[model samples]
Target chain A: MAGRRVIPGFGLSLGFTLFYLGLLVLLPLAALVVKASSLGFAGFAQVLGSPQVQAALRVSFVSAAIAALGNGLFGLLLAWVLVRYRFIGRRAIDALVDLPFALPTAVAGIALATLYAPQGWIGQWFARADIQIAYTRAGIVVALTFVGLPFVVRTLQPVLLDLDAEVEQAARSLGASRWQTFSRVILPALVPALITGMTLAFARAAGEYGSVVFIAGNMPGQTEIAPLVIMTRLEQFDYAGATAVGAAMLAVSLLLLLAVNLLQAWTRRKLGGA
Target chain B: MAFHRILRSFTALALITAALLTQIAGCSSKDGDTAQPGTSLTLLNVSYDPTRELYKEVNAAFADDYRRKTGIDVRIEQSHGGSGKQARSVIDGLQADVVSLALGYDIDQIAAKASLLPADWQCRLPCNSSPFTSTIVMLVRKGNPRAIRDWGDLTRQGVSVITPNPKTSGGARWNYLAAWAFAQRNGRDPREFLAALYANVAVLDLGARGSTTTFVQRNIGDVLLTWENEAYLALKEFGADRFEVVVPSISVLCETPVAVVDTVAMRHGTRNAAEAYLQFLYTPQAQDIAARHGFRPRDASVAARYADKFAPLVLVGIDSFGGWPQAQARHFAQGGLFDQLYGGR
Candidate 1:
């Protein structure tokens, strides 16, 4: 809480934030578990043990990991370009970077499917060239990449802006190479932001449904993702099956996110000490 | 302090820009699908989005005819989504006049969701009041490369099957029903056959069209469980040489029903139009177009002309499963047996 109330009702606002988050996020998830409790142990196990559920878990988390890893490396490059350069239509390019964040997941999915199908605008070219990007493991990654990019870019943007150019200049003054200054100084400050971005991206990709559904081609063992599987359970009225898969996914992702956040905190502290 | 003000202003500007963009987008969508003006008769037809074009044409025809006969304006407002979602919407008081959904059971959910649609509503209507029906057909590679002639061939180890999530697509119910029937006819218990069948499924996308993308666009599956009209459309849209329809030995009848939402119509004061609109669904003109779209016309003679399109079957209607209510409770209802078989871990 603020020591002095510069703004009226700071505590109230914080309470409202917690209450809103609790109502919207925590309660629904809790209800999901509560509803799932009606299922006995055998019932729960039966729901989770199905081949389809197993396959979906693999697709959801693995693709999310692949997407996060891929985005982390590439999103950094993209952020650097945006921050360091003044290109023609630079503002327009900046606006376009947020398109994924703005567009509906459903519309994005449909557009990508149309673009990358075997006979789609771009897909036709890929087919002729013997490359495939739609409806395989590749398409899921592409979708994850689509929704995840803005997170990394937006996260790193301000940090990049706040970064002191003098540090790089001082390193160069000390006869340190360009690569050495980047690898040691700039990269460290950006680590916390990068990890935050990757966490956001990974979490988003893990639960992503609409865009992935259109492009994933929904192959059971291969292209099937966990969210779609949870949906299938919901449709079949298998609330327990949906929840079990969801809970499992949440646990795994939470562990991963914890590790990432801890790494980020460590990085931030190191940068602070320096 | 001055620099801090600029930074705060910069964030405020970005938030404003995002907010303005979302508002414009939101307002534009507000009336994107508004109903026609000055229609004394309002008919709410819960339906699929793909059928919007077809319904537009049919509604145009119906409006002309309905106006000529009644001397009053009539409009059909179509609500589209996954049929199950749509059904729940109506059940939860979407104020639907006549419910034309992807399946009988979805309409049945309106009755089941509350006391809104009666439990025995199916029995109350003749032939369950299902206006139109479809069957599942296989969309194969342009040349049928894998020679996936039937459902059995789909299980030939390496043959991957692509279908919409049966949970979302009412048509996928036909797809699942057909698969079960295929297994049952082949002397395998429906359960074992389903497990094996789902084993070959590679991608279980969320909707029918999405699954079609997997088949036609991605070329991932050996066979695709698709609607009859969609199969016909795919062949026509893609080169005829691009896809072939494989009729199974026994096909499941996908009955799409329409019923008057008595409660909603009474509230909206569209009862006459709503009731007439549902009655008009059985008209000869509607049947013709319904048949043209590869949907089996409920009318007799028209179905004969189109008989060749549909495979001969033992007529596995929802009646065989003790009607819509029982079938819903047994199979597709939440945690129903189908879930146990397919989704159960």
Candidate 2:
């Protein structure tokens, strides 16, 4: 088999990949699914259908989506700056983008909470305006955005770096405006990478707990997130209910990610075939 | 060629070093597990947060007293976290020789789930095995800017409150019930009062310490609903001049219970030491230590000595709500009263 393939050890490498993924990812998820299945389909639906659980899921998904959209806009601008411009501290800025990935999420949460609490340094300004940030839904979004920023910026950097400036020059030569060049020529090429980055960010933010919990205020059916609801159930020793909610979250996340993937594929086929 | 050979040699050296380290770790852990007859014994006391300081003093004093009396050197180890989380650890087999958790329900969980101890473990010791007790109190900013005097004041609009999530913090459960008791005692609808109280909460942190941070360090809320000891702790930690504790007219009596895990203790052959360690907590010396750490000592004389330290208040015990099991099921459970009340907003 090794001799037959252009790349050696096809069978061995594929086996290793499967084993690694199965051990690290699929095993725990399979256990979660098994535990969740104990609730049966009806019990699972009832658990997720509860008003509190519904509210929590809405908070988690909506905040994660908003955070991901914010990341997509800002992350693209950041990656573009690093790739297309020559500036002092460019390398430092690029390295700084990975800080969120390195810092413990609890630390980021505490820091964010302290910085955004009503009387905090940044929060004081908002307070003067009679606007609350920490202990509100806005606070969860802030924490999620902090955690998911690196995912977007890191994902887009490579693709942005590889994008040729000559393509923009070619569009300019053909009497296209700057916006037209970016929208028609440059943007279509970056769409797939942007979607991938946004999806990764959304997935990360959706599952975030430690950072968001500190700032969430955690009012049920209000600021409460789905992860906190699972934690609450576990605290009550309702393992079956906890896993039921978790399984529902996992299924929904999978569906959303799959849709994004399909959209990415469609964009790739349209552009690649052209 | 020489670089590749050097890298290979280093890789082999790393593997050899890793193997050697694991062998040493295995040997040391094996040695620490067994209790030899006359030399020394080990007991792991799994506890909850806010008792860290109290236990530190108790552990040191008890260790000295045990060595002096029995001449068998006893070392007590400790593991602390959120109450329910610590209980879950014991249930999942953390080998806790004794568990001195924040509430009765947590210990009850160990009995029910793990069978590590008898279901009647609470009756095994005096005072339901709670050597010291605490009550829910309000910690307010200095000068009481909001004019917050009681549980009723907490529900007032424009008065931000800070308390942990009852689902996560044992102390928060007591806080919630304390407010409920106060409302009932005042002849108002308890559920509506609770809903209003939580409506004013600025942050529902996961534990007592986190809520203290929100109230003290971050300065987010107008008041902090917390354990009596925790309120005092915040005053001592952040300077008494910055905050003051208000003993509500009525509050819930927080009974933090302890017990020996029969299975773990018997297996380790440290049952005697574990029982003795808990027994030591009831002594005058340990009770005094508990008082200094801001807990209301169960010892009458010790509590009297510190009576001036704690303000007078009517404290309703867990029995008022049909004990922890019923209270836990009614209030803190999923879609229970806490969820129902807080979810309304």
For each candidate, how many residue pairs have backbone atoms clashing (under 3 Å)? Answer: 15, 0
Task: Give the per-residue lDDT of model 2 (tens digit) for A39-136.
Answer: 99888878988888999999999999999999999999999998889999999999999999999999999999989988888999999999899989
Error of 1 at A84 (Å): 2.3
**lDDT of residue B227 for candidate 2:** 88
**What is the DockQ score of candidate 2, to 2 decimals?**
0.49
Identify the candidate with maximal TM-score: 2
Against the true structure, candidate 2 reaches a TM-score of: 0.93
Q: lDDT (0-100) at residue B224 of candidate 1?
A: 86
Q: Output the number of the lDDT-best candidate.
A: 2
- Candidate 1, residues B1-345, lDDT tens digits: the string is 544776799999999999999997775444222223443455778886346655776787888887877676787888877777677667656777777777777766677655665666655555667777777788887677888777778778888888776777787777887887777778878877777887788777666776776678666678888888788777867777877888766777777777777777665666667666766667888888888877778899888888887667654665666765676667666556666765542
Model 1's CAPRI class? acceptable
Model 2 regions lying over 4 Å from their true place: A4-8, B1-38
